[model samples]
Each structure stands twice: as structure tokens, then as C-alpha cells.
Target: MAGRKKTFHGVSVGILMVKTGFRRLPGDVGHAGTWDFPVQYRVVEGATPDKMMALESSGLLDEFKAAALDLVAGGVDGIATTCGFLALYQRELTAACGVPVASSSLLQVPLAHRLIAPDKRVGILTFSRESLHASHLEAVGVAADTPVEGMPADSVFVTAIKSGDTVPRFEAMRAEVLQAAERLLGSHPDVGAIVSECANMTPFSADIAERFGIPVFDGVSLINWFQAGLRPRRYPQA
Candidate 1:
């Protein structure tokens, strides 16, 4: 392969981060420690969690595109975002960046749907159930009727993320996430798998999976799969 024009090398993914002050735990996509492979990050100023929830009117698509282009110039093989709601811009970002872009973990929903039993369905746990509309799911090839559950509006998980709490209550946040999962499973007993729509929820994916006895897919899972394709491992010949 021909060498590409890049300021740096060896980074396979460039993560476009929303500007926020929330504490990013180890499993969060924004945290460097969450990834086994090195990743580059570019923060899109003014892209807050609230604005991202209503991305269609956020007027930040251009800003996100510009940031992604900048990451490509800096040498990332692909693009990703810290917000799952960015799935709305999947087509635009992929076109603008001229590289593979996994804009949201929700992109895995269609595949998750296929991985489960014919009668079973994939459920979503999001930051705001109301904000996640049909267009967002349709953009990613997910069924508009897919079951979805959100953290309570006043729950610690939603509050900390929206307020950008620098000192988040980890246990409280975990509990809220688990409760949301429980609600999802309770309402839709046929949910064979789950896709976490908030990047911050990645930390509790294991707990959700273990507690609910269902497969949980989140930002980490999406990015790891994205990275594998960008830099597949090689086996030495015997």
C-alpha cells in the first residue's frame, strides 16, 4: 500500500468527542484507557449532550464534518463519535471524511437483530427515549419499532451526563443504567439482545449483560470491530 499523507501514524481510529466536562470512566469511549489500540481524539466544540439529543436542529453537522476531516488529516484510518445519537450523521460523516465512520454504536442494531432468534428482537437503552426517533433508527437500518428504554429524566445517569458532572457518582449511575435495562427487558421479554445508545453507558455493559442474561453491545464493541477492519491482525506463518 502506498504511504498516505498524515501528520502521525499507527492510530487506527479518530474519535470525534462532544465538548463536555463529565467524568469519563475507564470503559467510556472518551477515555483513552478504554481502547486496547491507540486512538486519536478531536473535540467538536459546542456539541453538548443536550444538543446531540436533538441533533437535527443542533446546526453542528458542519462542525462535526470539519472535525472529522481534521482527524483524517492527522492520520486516523477511520472516524467515530462519542455520542450514539450521531447515528443521524452516519451517511454524511462517511462521505465527508472519505473514510469509514462508525458514528454511533446504534449502528450495530441491525446486525444484532440478525444475530438473535427470528421471534426475538434487539432492544435499545438510550440517554433519552423521546429523543431517539424513527429517523435515527432508519438511518442505521434499524426497525423504527425496535424496543427502547431510557434512564429516568431525573436519574443520576442522565443528570450527571447532561450537567457534565466532573465527579460523577459511579455506583448511582450504574444502578440507573441497570434499572433502565430491567425496564427494557420487563417491557419486551422477547429482547434477545441490547444495544446501549449512550457512550457513557459502556462501563456497565457487562453488568447489564450478566444481570439480564442478554448480550450487550455498546460504543466499545462498535469501535473495536471498526478497528479490527482498519488494522486486522496478522498471523505469522509456521
Candidate 2:
């Protein structure tokens, strides 16, 4: 038999990172060590967290689409983004880059709902409720009226990430996220699962799941799944 031709693809997933100076802890999407597979990263210039939270990320679609194309050109098998708010640009990015684009964790909402009982629905914990518009949810196939809770505007997580500050106190950020999760559960008692809409919130996903005894999904988990499709597992022959 002829030898298989060698391929030089370096990574399976390419991340479209937001242009921010905030500290990304180990589990955060922006942190390279968060993934088990080699992944590429390209920051979308001017796509700041604050601007995105304010629904201004639409202005940076061209920049993100261009970055996705760059990653595709570099041989990445799939693409994802660091901010869930980018759900608004998923279709455009997928069309432009000609690759599977998992632009936001919000994409898990529909699947989460399907995984749970009919009476129980998926709830979202995000960085900004006011900023998580119906358009963003609808674009990602989430219900327009889905229950959502947001981190406190004055939270350490919000302040640090939004301002691009490099000092995010992990403990405080976790506490704030827990508060948001609790609030989400309190207000939406039928929520059987949680989906965090801020990619940085992935660091506390396990904590949220343990505390609430419910499934928690986030950008990191979604990205990992997406990468698996890009490079599916192969079993060794016996």
C-alpha cells in the first residue's frame, strides 16, 4: 500500500479572541492552557468586552470575520470566539470563513433544553442582562424570552474584564458568578440547567454545577466539543 500523504495542520480549533488586557485564568478561553488540544488564537482588534456588552460588537463584525478567515487560511479546522455575545455574528462568520463557527456558548441553550424535562428550561448567566438582547439569543437559536441573569454591574469580574484591567480577583469573581447563578435559580425555579454566556465565566462552571446540582455549560466546554468534531477520536486496533 502507498504511504499516507503527510498533512501539516497545526491545530484543530482557532479562537477569535477579544482585544482585552484582562487576566484570563487557566480555564478561561483566552488562556491557552485551557484546552487539551493545540489551538490557534487571533485577537479581533477593537472588539473590547465593554463595547461588546453594550451591543456595539456589531461594529466589529468585519474585524472578527477577517480574523476567522485568517485562521482558516492558517489551517485551523474550526473556529470559536472568546465572547458569547458574538452569537450575533455566528452565521455571518461561518459563511465568510467557510468553517464551522461556534461563536458563543449560548448555542448550547437549545440542546440544554432538549436534555432536560419539558417543564424545566435552560437559564443563562451572563456578564450583562441588559446587553444580552433578544437579537443575540434569536440569532443563536435561543428563545427570545429565555430566562437570564447577569453579573452585578459593579462586580469585580465585570469591572476588571470590561475595563481591560489585568487584575481580576478569582475568588471575588467566583463569588459574583455564584450570586448570579443563585439569582438565576431563584427567579427561574424551573431551570434544570445553566449556560454561562461570558466565556471568562468558564472558570466557575464546575462550582456552579456542584452548588446547583444542575448541568452547567459554557464556551470552554462548547469549544472543546467543537474541536472534537474537527479532529474526531480514533481508536487503536486490538
TM-scores vs. true structure, each candidate: 0.98, 0.94
Best by TM-score: 1
For candidate 2, the C-alpha RMSD (Å) to the true structure equals: 2.8
Error of 1 at 84 (Å): 0.7
> Given candidate 2, what's the lDDT at residue 171?
96
lDDT of every model, 2 decimals: 0.92, 0.87
Model 1 TM: 0.98
Q: What digit string (tens of lDDT, one per residue) describes model 2 on residues 1-238?
A: 0232324365878899988987889899989988888888998887777678765535787888889888887777789988999999888888898768899999999999999999999999998998999999999899988999998888898888877777757999999899999999999999999999998999999999999899999998898889888788999999
What is the model-wide C-alpha lDDT for candidate 2? 0.87
lDDT of 1 by residue, 1-238 (tens): 2488889899989999999998989899999999898999999998988898889899999999999999998898899999999999999988898889999999999999999999999999999999999989988898989999988889888888788889957899898899999999999999999999999999999999999898999999999999999999999999
Superposition-based RMSD of candidate 1 using all C-alpha atoms, in angstroms: 0.9
What clash pairs does model 1 have?
Answer: none
Candidate 1 stretches with Cα past 4 Å from truth are none
Least well predicted 10-residue stretch by lDDT in candidate 2: 1-10
Q: List the residue pairs that clash in candidate 2.
A: none
